[model samples]
Target: MTFTRQGCLLVIAVALASPVLAEGPDPVRGAELFPIRCVECHVITDGAEKKIGPSLKGLIGRTSGTLEGYDYSDAMKTAGIVWSEQTLKTYLVAPRKMVPGTKMNFNGLKRPGEVEDVVAYLLEAGT
Candidate 1:
């Protein structure tokens, strides 16, 4: 079959994307994903007061229920988790399962790449 110019461009685009697809989630994509997925309820600004949720600045090494002023759910306040890359990756995959009764209502990220990307983004942004 002969390819039209548009079709050829589409093929080239897909080809360029293949490596990124294989290499796992990009932080740039993670940054893109954050606003769409988490920004409604969370913010990443440093020293900012809590919005619907606590600011995610310095989130990486933080204790789960210890965001100072933000009121945490009983279950979360008592669970005693320390946020690490691995823990964040797993928690992002299933929030309710990881911390049942947490106040946040997110359904959890469905894809591994999405989780990875978000975790990667948070690592940078949280700092």
Candidate 2:
């Protein structure tokens, strides 16, 4: 089919902007993934409780290592990060790399889209 340059650009822009082409984080998928990937160490329920890791009940907007009652690694405490969607996405990719001395043992989520999904779940459930 013949197409003008402007028409091709418009088509490309529309494709790029389409929701089907740019699906965002899915909380339901995130919820399913959370149990598989993060439930072992973290809890998202209400309380200052300790599991293998700290309670993630109020994760969004919370400063790293500041959750009461959970003892954080010196590195985490000193990193001084405020948890947010963007930061969570970065940190979830490589926990140790993000905070070199963090006590979290899991290597970090490596699967495509898993980090975003899990972060979405945490934001939804932890809040």
In the predicted model 1, the residue pairs found to clash are: none
Candidate 1 lDDT, 15-82, residue by residue in tens? 68776556786788999999999999899987757778888988988988888888888988998889
Model 2: runs farther than 4 Å from truth?
1-22
Q: Candidate 1 at 26: error in angstroms?
A: 1.4
RMSD of 1: 6.9
Give each model's whole-structure lDDT.
Answer: 0.86, 0.87
Q: Go through the candidates in order and give the C-alpha RMSD of each one to the true structure.
A: 6.9, 4.8
lDDT of each residue in 23-127, candidate 2, tens digit only: 767888899988888888988889887798999998999999999998889999999999999999989999999999899998888876688778878888877
**Native-referenced Cα lDDT, model 2:** 0.87
The TM-scores, one per candidate, come to 0.81, 0.81
Give the Å error, residue 9, model 2: 16
